[model samples]
Target: MTPPHPLAPAAPPVVPHVEVPTPRVPPPSSLSLPTPRRRGRGDDALPRPQSVVPGALAALAVSGACLALTLTAPAAPALLVAIVLGVVARAAHAVPASFERGLAWVGRRVLRTGVVLLGLQLSARDVLALGPPELGVLVVTVATTFSATLWLGRRLRVGRSLTLLVATGFSICGAAAVAAMSPVADAEDDDVATAVALVTLYGSVAILVVPVVARAARLSDRTAGLWAGMSVHEVAQVVAAAGAVSAAALSVAVVAKLARVVLLAPLVTAVGVVRRRGGARSGGAAVPVVPLFVIGFLVAVAVRTVGGVPDVAVPVVHGATTLALGAAMVGLGTQVHVARLARSGGRAVLLGAVATTVAMTVSLGGLLAVGALG
Candidate 1:
């Protein structure tokens, strides 16, 4: 507002006072947050030979031993035998830290590859051939078992992480489900260990129990196999359980189990959403909408369904699947620390038992209803 001399330069215009936000510098801890180890799909680095060879060799040795044992005792499933030896070794501290990386690699990568190959054995047409009723049974069984396990876990006061892990494992694909769910759920290592142990214990027992129950119930081999596939925790467990009945049953069982395996991606995504909404932090890498291997599985299924695979390749693929899966089972077996599991708490064990029963009961009941409806 002051008058200025004509010789003076014109005054600059007054600028409005605008508050600029100071860029927030995160604390050092936040800036350098350590990434949690990812066991879920898409974390596929090949470990160093020094880190991988020892455990891989050990797993191969156990797989060979299991195979030899199965020849002498046809009733014993090689997969079951492999897991048992792994559990025994783990309980005895026979597995060293050196074997950890290799075993983890085999358990995740090799196991997933086997699962992908497993799809070659299935025909989507065959699955659809079951019509809506049988398919409905599979869906109902998975949902009911998952819900029942969650309910029982709450009633038993088990930790939410453990409960979620166990529920995912039992209602889906056993140890694989536990592995997939851990990161999304922000589960602790101890919770993971306990969940894996429970799934291993009950899933192993299921290998024996399911066949016996199927026999006692006088179910047809197909029906029995379907029940096993629907109810059993792991792919290996389902194979062992259904195989104990007959070759035909084993075929049916694998197809049925794969159907349930297909549900894993969506389920994991849904759980991740629920956790995020509940203000839970992810413990590891972001959850993949669909794991790479699961996509591979679907591709394989499509190939087989379309008759793109030659007949000569069938048995070779089957043999490879068996070998890869069998080796992975050895790694799974070693994760079971019986002593640690026992010391953890009885409530977890009880929850596992209830979950197992719920899976079996719901699957069998659904199968029966399907039969009636058919």
Candidate 2:
């Protein structure tokens, strides 16, 4: 122990009384950078249109199959086949994790765009060409079936969402109708898929059954066309059913079906109003009375009506529309797990059957009342 030199004054006693202030770090809230959005909600950081490429490719394959069938077999319902193929593929293996977001985008955004373009398939002239009696029959058939199916759905103890979706598909234009109403009705994705599946199944049956019945009932070709237009589910299915009867029947059926498609605008608006009122009562957000895509639909229809799109372009535009919708169907169908749907879907199938029956009955009644049935 070396002693310190005496001249080096003894070190001053350490000051015990002084308290040092801890340097303060500002809380995380005080940081200057803008806070980033949480990831799961799919904010700005998420992929956009490009994200849809993989799923779009998947859908493209379905579209190719659709074209192949259209060119070859000619009688096959290509979109329906696309849906089945997509469902089978997905049932074998879930879509890859990396492709989920893209598939979702196609199911919603791309589907919406396809639906908007569906408007181009119609012209106001073609719609109005169906005289008042024809229009009356259409409106009555759709309105009655839509309301009746909804009422019956509740009696069957089905979920309101499923009931609404099924009714829309059966009454209006099949899968397109289901897609249109799903957003306004706040239906679940699975609910929409179920509705589309039912429509595809029943509509396909109608293509086969309708022609046979027309002959058995001895329905005049014109009356049979009206019946096919009113009772069948999809435009294509109606065409097939009527075409099987005769070329004249095909002409009438397509016109009649287009009239129904035109009526979609008014029907959807009514549904939106009803849904918004219900949502208000339930303290939910009010769904818009017309979705933006629907407005685009109207715009497309009007453009077609005004001859904005050249006649020669119709086929090309129609092809694109089909492709877009086919892709959407593939995406929607892929979400469906047939085994699971079957396990949980007893009521759903029953509702679909009941709805189809109701629609067909109402349509036939309308045509009979109008003397369209000779």
Candidate 3:
């Protein structure tokens, strides 16, 4: 068919004007792509600020709710209640990320403030009443218990921070002591909660068990009170435990408990010293010889000693202290992760038990040795 067009029309033979588009490839010079950031030495310094509201609000709400619960059940201190609520709420995953900043503020700032006010509860007059022998025994008990628990904790493979917290709480005034030391030791919220839980459980049991033992032993009211005060974890628990023995016992119990509380400053100082030494050896940033919070606590005690805070205003100050501490507890509690705590296993509990046992045995022996147990 194309034979006639071989010369003239061969080029256009049966060809149709059809267009097929090819995929476009842009020139390299015109393309713009993002280059990933190269991480460097400033990685650990000056952490970027993040949104911190949701967690903070959740913590504050938890604190308020728990504080209300304590009102209904006076046996349950609001501080302890806050910790439990925090753990439960956190495990439910109800805490939102937005509250992170608020929670951080609540945990660190409120905690330090509570420790400062804790000092107003003490006075130089009460310190004098404790006497040298009683003070010596109390100090020895705390020192021994703290050291022994740390050793036991390591052997049991408990986390280091948890071990320190449990030892402090048990050897001193339970949850209050734990909270005071949490910041000094740089402890996490869950660790503090776990330690607080341990101290509260033992302290509660002591309230019931100690009085029965005192009665069975036919101990004098003074002796019974001294025993309760030395061994019990909380001041309220101490009163309840000793009061069950006799009215006189309650008065003595309060005195003995205060002696323990006064020692908190020294204990915190000792811990800071140890940590500082360790940090120095490891070449970490210089750790302070004394924590700023401890200084504030001591100042509060000194002011009270001189009656810088008037008698008429004492109750108001006490109420404020409770509220501040209660809020801090609530803040600390919300950071707890119950499942993670459980996974940490039995060592923490065992460490707490060892501390309790040592504290009771040593303090009781001291009271008897000094003829203070009557």
lDDT of all predictions, in order shown? 0.77, 0.79, 0.76
Over 1-374, each residue of candidate 2 has an lDDT whose tens digit, in order, gives 99999899888878778788999987878977778655534411345556667777877777777867876886766677777776876888857766666666677777778788889888989877676876887888888888888998898887888898899889989988887877777776677788888898888888888799889988888878988888789888898899999998899888888888887777778888877777632124577788878898899999989998888997888778778777777777777777767764888888888777877777777777778443
Cα lDDT over the full model 1 = 0.77
What is the C-alpha local distance difference test score of candidate 2? 0.79
- lDDT of candidate 3 over 1-374, digit per residue (tens): 44665456545567788898998877765557655444322211222234435555566666666667766886887777877776666678776666655665667677778778878888868867777887888888878888899899999999888898888887888777887777566677778878878888888888888888888878878878888888888876897798889999999888888888888888878887888878742123455667788889899999999999887887777666667766667766777776788888477777777788888889888888888443
What is candidate 1's lDDT per residue for 76-190, written digit by digit as tens? 6666667667778877888899887777767666777776787776666666645577778888888888888899889988888888989998998876677666656666555
**Model 3 residue 203 lDDT score:** 82
TM-score of each: 0.70, 0.86, 0.81
Please list the residue runs of candidate 3 whose C-alpha ends up more than 4 Å from where it truly belongs after superposition.
1-61, 280-284, 372-374
List clash counts for every candidate, in order.
0, 0, 8
TM-score of 2: 0.86
Cα shift from native, residue 166, model 1 (Å): 2.6
> Cα deviation in Å at residue 191, candidate 3?
1.3
